[model samples]
Target chain A: MKNNHPVDEEPPIEKPPFFNSWKGMYWLVLGNLAFMIALFYIITKIYE
Target chain B: MRPLDWIVLLGTIGFIVIYGIWKTRGSQDIEGYLKGDNSMKWWTIGLSIMATQASAITFLSTPGQAYEDGMRFVQFYFGLPIAMVIISVTVIPIFYKLNVYTAYEFLENRFDLKTRSLAALLFLVQRGLAAGITIYAPAIILSTMLGWSLTITNLVIGVVVIIYTMSGGSKAVSVTQKQQMAVMMGGMIIAGIMVVSYLPDNVGFGDAVAVAGKLGKMNVVDFNWDWKTSWDDRYNFWSGITGGLFLALSYFGTDQSQVARYLGGKSIGESRLGLLFNGLLKIPMQFMILFIGVMVFVFYQFNEPPVFFNEGTKSKLYATEHATELRTLEANYSSIFEEKKQAMQSLVSALKTEDEAAIAIAETKVENLNAAGKEVREEVKALITKAVPNAETKDTDYVFISFVMKYLPAGLVGLLLAVIFAAAMSSVASEMNALASTTVVDIYKRSINPNGSPMHYVNASKVLTIAWGIIAILFATFASMLDNLIQAVNIIGSIFYGTILGIFLVAFYFKRIKGNAVFFAAILAEVVVLYCFYFTEIAFLWFNVIGCVAVIVFGFILQTLIGKNEKELVKV
Candidate 1:
């Protein structure tokens, strides 16, 4: 059956240079956030 | 400012405006004018999104915030990356698939016309006012500090933004933002470097950081949890992650100004990449800006700092009945500054010695001296209020700019001023573009003239752009009455964003809820949000969470009631 919905037609997903997939890119972003939070926590402790 | 400063400032701003208009000269059709020919790359889109969000107030108020309140303000962005990822995974694909001109247009598809109009109207109200603030924030501060005409400053920013934005529309906004972002970041980075170099010969960067940490200026995170007090604490880890998440999601997902940025991308991938890039870099960019403010705090430790940062207000105090009281406060302030300076030096020396015991004692002394200095500053503020009842005595907004003008070299001063103007113009241009697009697409074309020719809609968009620009300028001219320009913008957004986000979230996720239920629920939710804002001490960020959840709960209840009514009628 042909789906008429444009969303289901899925546009081609180009992989970012460093990440293997969009999911990988998202994980990298989340990882970066975690790292930043940890680093900020350390900075707070060191300075406090 | 010197001749070199004027030349740099004017040359930079002039080049950006002319280049933008020239590059986007042929946007004759509605789609071309409103959506930028759908040709923006990931980097351009990313930078444009960032520039649109980082208004002049962000540049002016954030550093000042750090100077006064420490780096806890950085926590506010902790949820932004999460918001970005979620939007990329869900909202971007849907928006691209629908190919809607405005985010609100998607509401009409998922729900009903009334729902779409309601969300669009909320956005227009919040963003239209925000556009004015974007221009007014820098204008008020710059005019007072530089002794420029306030009217002229407002007109200069509004007119420059209107010209390119009205002429070339969204393409012009996106194209010019690339250059504006470059100038803003470049100017700020240079200012940061110059501030450190201008410090006393003995004070290196490491010493400055240590001194700032000792004085509590380097406080970047706070994990304390007290539910009773949490709602009032503006910038803590908990409020930031939860409330910040809701705010960011609503902002990036439902706000037309942001949706319009990604909507102009060439493809969904490009748009998603653009948003993800912003998520990756925004926090670090904010950290750098706040760190520069901390550097300014350190710079003042050695030098005699102003008792109040706003010199314009200070000059006014000289001619007032309380001038004698002001002089006494100034004398007390000077004495405290000397004591604080000595204590700071003692702390710096202790830090260098690597003796923990000495460092601890010096830290206590420095903190006490700093508190004394703050008490004198408070007295100055009280005297200013007495001298001029209507004056804005919170001078933190003037801290960084005052430092730049009085201390930086002449040409760099001009460049930094250009940075402020560029940030203001970039945000204002995007806002005008988005506001016009929404007014034309979601309101005018969708309802008033569904069959209007493409050319006619294009012209209408241009006219609406001019109209919004003028309205913004008028609003900015009178915006001086508002307190803390940055907070004012955010408070405005918070009041409306939650209800709007709730409506969209229902349409997206709650398939069982019908249009009537969600539309009425959004209205009720907005009223509740406003009630909380005006009556309670709940932090503004929590409004997003509250408003969103209220809509969902209300939607389900309304739907069930309607279902009961229908069943009863059938039995009858």
Candidate 2:
């Protein structure tokens, strides 16, 4: 149980690497886009 | 029925059990017991999450879904990757900053004790039920295929998972998951390839796909925007975006089973990467599994499958006075199916030869034959029910398993059975872990003994794991004749996820609302969601939407009514 402190004081941040890095965000978007494309291509090919 | 299959099953279990015990080493400390000392790497977290989500239903029924329906069930997960990105951005930072063990811990910090307890209570109920389905799913398939007693099968699945999970906690769950995933995927892909290879040499992959497509078993997407049509329902754009987002957010963000997996990550980046990896792989993995079902459908077109797939019911029907009638219906369906198969073959040949006229004729014949087959199957199904009054009449769950047992080679049959067990164990183990963590961290440590020794907490965690295991088995024994155990589990989650998500949303975004207001809103939201499920034509996924919106809308009304007197205390 955390000590019930006021909301104004910022909680201690663990700040693990790449918490909000551009590379992480890039890979996330890129990975999803690639997967979507692959799925679409397969479905379209099968239908065609 | 070969020695090879026995060797494979035994060897796989032996390795997983010994490896789990070796890695778990048993914990005496709460930190080690509940959180795994924050030592798991990104890959382990990734695999653990995948295993938890996969379950026996994913393996056993997914192919059947694809085989019976088509690849469109994959759309159910189209919203997952987007939801993962949303969680990584919004929920991850908040929970990590709080340094919480269970997701509910963050609820207490952001909201109040009552809100946390309510959310935890909801999770305990839903996951407790889902865990049983996960165990019961494979047990049903194995019992039906191998002719084992359902009770014995359920006990075997529960006991193996419990021993490993009790020994290792999160680490054991992760390690066994990594291995299980490798085997499960390898087994599934091999099974898919073998399906193609085992097809008549003249029927190549192209022909198999063509047959499945011609039969409407390859329909992967429905562009129609019909809210009323259950065909193009919740597994679509709107529910996928709104309701799916809410469910995924609450699950990964607040559910301890998932939260504990990431907390074991060596670093937050690793955790994020692990989640992101899941986002990338999950849809395709689901798609592939569903695609296998379509192939299985194609395989059955060439072969004369039973009018009803479940042998258990079929046998009872065979022994009854309706035996002649059922066999006659089956024989008629078989002949009609053969005619349709000829039509399908002609259609495939026409496509290759570019004969659109032949294609048209063949397509119409095939559709009519399929419609006719459904009528015959339904009659046989009715006879089965009349013969064995209380038997499971729905046979979609049996299609894929039936194919595997009748067609696959002996050694591969054993490996596939192992895959079923692995899938069941993976999901159940995670459920047991999550259930244990929620009980210990949210309820036990907070209320029962805040200052309890590490050894005492460790013991408590183990006991809770065993207790939840028994509860799940009991639920499995009585699981109603659900359409699909897979969908049933998700429906149960949908009923609760939105309200739980609403509470967490209030904690995260609605700062002015007190726990009291949100609590009332949550109960009202649940009632409203339940009403929608009962009274409206809305898909079950939309229940999440109804529930979330209800809480947010009703919460503000209650907050305004009450907060004026109390004065919104900025107690965060």
- Show model 2 residue runs off by greater than 4 Å: A1-27, A30-48, B227-232, B567-572
Evaluate every candidate with DockQ and list the scores.
Answer: 0.25, 0.09
Per-residue CA lDDT of candidate 2, range A1-48, in tens? Answer: 222323323332233344466456646655774567466547646764
lDDT of 2 by residue, B113-147 (tens): 88888889999988998898888888887887788
Among the numbered candidates, top TM-score falls to: 1
What local lDDT score does residue B434 receive in model 2, on the 0 to 100 scale? 95
For residues B234-319, what per-residue lDDT tens digits would candidate 1 score against the true structure? 89998899888999999999988888898998888889999999999999999999999988988998998888999999999988
Error of 1 at B477 (Å): 1.0
Please identify model 1 stretches exceeding 4 Å from their true place: A1-13
lDDT score, candidate 1, position B450: 94
lDDT of 1 at B347: 79
* Model 2: TM-score, first chain: 0.52
